[model samples]
Structure formats: C-alpha cells, structure tokens
Target: MQARYYTLNEARAALPVVKALMSQVQEARSEILRLRPEIWPVLQKAAHNGGNAAAGSVYSQFDKLETGVKGILKMGILVKDIDMGLIDFLSIRNGREVYLCWKHGEEDLSFWHDVNAGFGGRQPIDPEDF
Candidate 1:
C-alpha cells in the first residue's frame, strides 16, 4: 500500500479509531488463543473431512483482525513494536516523510526516512524544511 503522511492533528484525530481497532486486535488475539487448543482437533478433522472450511473460517477471522491492525498502523498511529519509538506528526516532502519522534528516548521528531523505510533507516528531519 502507498504511504500517506499525516500531520500531528491528523494523526491525533485517528486516535479514537486506532484505539478501538487496537482493542479489537487484542480481543481477537485472546479469542484465537482461547480457541487454539479446543479447535485444533476440530480444525484438523474439518481439514481432512472436506476443504478445511472450519479452519479456513478461523484463519480468515484472524487475517481480518491482523489486517485491521496494520491498517491503523499504516495511518501513522505508531503502536506496533513500542520499543521502537514514539512518532507524533508525519510529514511528506520531496517524496519522503518524517515521523516526529515523541518517545522516552528521543527528544524530537528529528528522525525520518522514506515511506517504505523502517526506523533503522531514519535520517534527521530538518526543522527548517517543513
């Protein structure tokens, strides 16, 4: 998916939605964990019985939940891998965007990188450049 840059306000605007989606992910994770043991045998039997319809349903639900989480993260609400860093505002300029760092270890949003790049590839965001 293409990357979309969001200002501090825009990213913040998504907080409620992101939080809700995160909650859903957590719930789905819990459901999957709870069902694993009981459903494994059933899933195995279903897989062997027909075309794995039962197992496919469970997997599809898991995929949907995972996709939902990624969708929120794609919007710039940095929640995945909290150990990475906190990112506030996101700005795109000259084909790249910078994430305003706002975490315990970073002082500012001075770090940045290409849309497809990860934290390790972040370059310093020049304040004067917008």
Candidate 2:
C-alpha cells in the first residue's frame, strides 16, 4: 500500500483520536509490565510455541496492545515507542518528507524532525513551516 501522508491540518484533525488510541496502548502496556512476573513463565512457554490457559490475563493485555497499535498503523501513523507513547505522522516540509513528532501527554503537536532524525532530533515546529 502507498504510504499515507498527512497535511498539517489533517494531522491535527486526527490528534484527538490518536490521543485516545495512545492512552489505550499505554494502559495495556503498563498492565503487561505489571503482570510480567506472573506471566514470565507463560511467556517463556509461548516463545517455545506452547500455550497456557493460566495466562489468560496476560494474553488479554497482549490482545489489547496489538489492537491499539494496529489501529494507529491502520491510520498511517508510525508508532515509534509504545513505552514512551512516541508517534510520527508523515508530512511534507520544504517539499521533502519529514515526521511530525508527538509524545504522550503533549496537548498539541508542535515538533517535527527530518525523516532520518528520529526522536532525538525533533525540533519545534515553526508556525510558518507547517
């Protein structure tokens, strides 16, 4: 499938839904981490292609995480770090593709980075740039 790129307005328009989805992703991830000790054995078994009915809760959290991440990807947003709730919307800047960077808890999307820059290279968006 061709990659979906968002205009600045379009990306902003999608922010509310993105925030909700990220909340789900983060909540599921936190629960998964919290259950790590209890589910470690089940996880190890599953790595060996075995299933354990005893780890149903862990499995349910995995389902929720997968659903949330997939939901975001289906909208063409790149989820960079689920733990940190980092995401990027592909957008054009100066006629080149760049990422509009956003993280969980941010009320607005106000940063951008070159395609190769990653999160470390994020820069505040200039109002005139977008």
Candidate 3:
C-alpha cells in the first residue's frame, strides 16, 4: 500500500463506478448486519480461538467488494482525511473518497484501499468480479 494522490477530475470521473461499488459495500454491510443475529454466536465461538473466523469471512467478502469498487475507480480514497473518516458522509449514502491509485488506464482508477490504510495498498480488481 502506497500513497497515490488524485486530482479532482480524476476522482470525479470515477464517481459512477465508485457509487456502484459503495452500493455493494452497503448491501454487504446490510446483509452482514441482517445475519448478525444468527452469526453472533458462531462469531463469538471463533473469537474464542483469537480469530473472528465467522465474522471474518463475511467481513472479508465485504472488504473485497469494497476494495474491488475502489480499484475499478482508480482513485485514492479517504472517506475522511487527517481530521475525519467516512462518518462525516455517512448520511449521504453513496458518498466515498476514492483517491488516485494510478495516473492512467481504462482502469485508471484501477484500485482502492481503505480509509485507514489510504491509497498505497490497492488490491487489483478482476474484471470478471464486476
């Protein structure tokens, strides 16, 4: 993970894709939460082993989808900056900060990392995954 900065236009151009990915992330989150009641105990059991095995699976999927979307957009995203995080735009639904991952390509915004980790660590997105 490296710090890849982005220009405003580059960030804006990828908005649609970012929005779509955000939608998936939200859906994954919703699904995780919806299933939490049934998942909690299993997750708790796994936590006993010092690992969030149960929840980790779901969370990994969520993170994958989230990162996948960010990667497609080729943006270095920080939902929040040195001061805040995604919480600031939580109410806006679809709002995300995709910083620049690279400077060019159809996959210009070819990767996305996390708010905490920033753009330096974007994982590739397989076209088939979309």
Q: Where does candidate 1 stray beyond 4 Å?
A: 48-67, 70-96, 100-130
Model 1: per-residue Cα lDDT at residue 95: 52
For model 2, how does the per-residue alpha-carbon lDDT over 1-130 read when each residue is reduced to its tens digit?
A: 2348998889899999999999999998998888888779877867647556546777888898998888889899999999899999999998899999999999999999999999999999986777
Tell me the TM-score of each prediction against the true structure. Answer: 0.51, 0.89, 0.43
lDDT (0 to 1) per candidate: 0.57, 0.88, 0.47
The runs of at least 3 residues in candidate 2 whose Cα sits more than 4 Å from the true structure, single-residue gaps closed, are 43-54
Candidate rank order under lDDT: 2, 1, 3
Model 1: per-residue Cα lDDT over 8-100, one tens digit each: 445546655655665566666666776687669987666556535546656866986677667666775555343332344466655555564
Model 2 RMSD in angstroms:
2.3
Please give, for residues 43-125, the per-residue lDDT of candidate 3 as tens digits. 67775456555576677766865675455434444343211112111111125543333322133444544445554565553
By TM-score: ranked, best first: 2, 1, 3
Angstrom error of the Cα, residue 33, model 3: value is 0.6
Model 1 — which ten-residue stretch has the worst lDDT?
Answer: 80-89
Q: What is the lDDT of residue 57 in candidate 1?
A: 59
Q: Name the lDDT of candidate 3.
A: 0.47
Between candidates 1 and 2, the TM-score winner? 2
The candidate that achieves the highest lDDT relative to the unseen native structure: 2
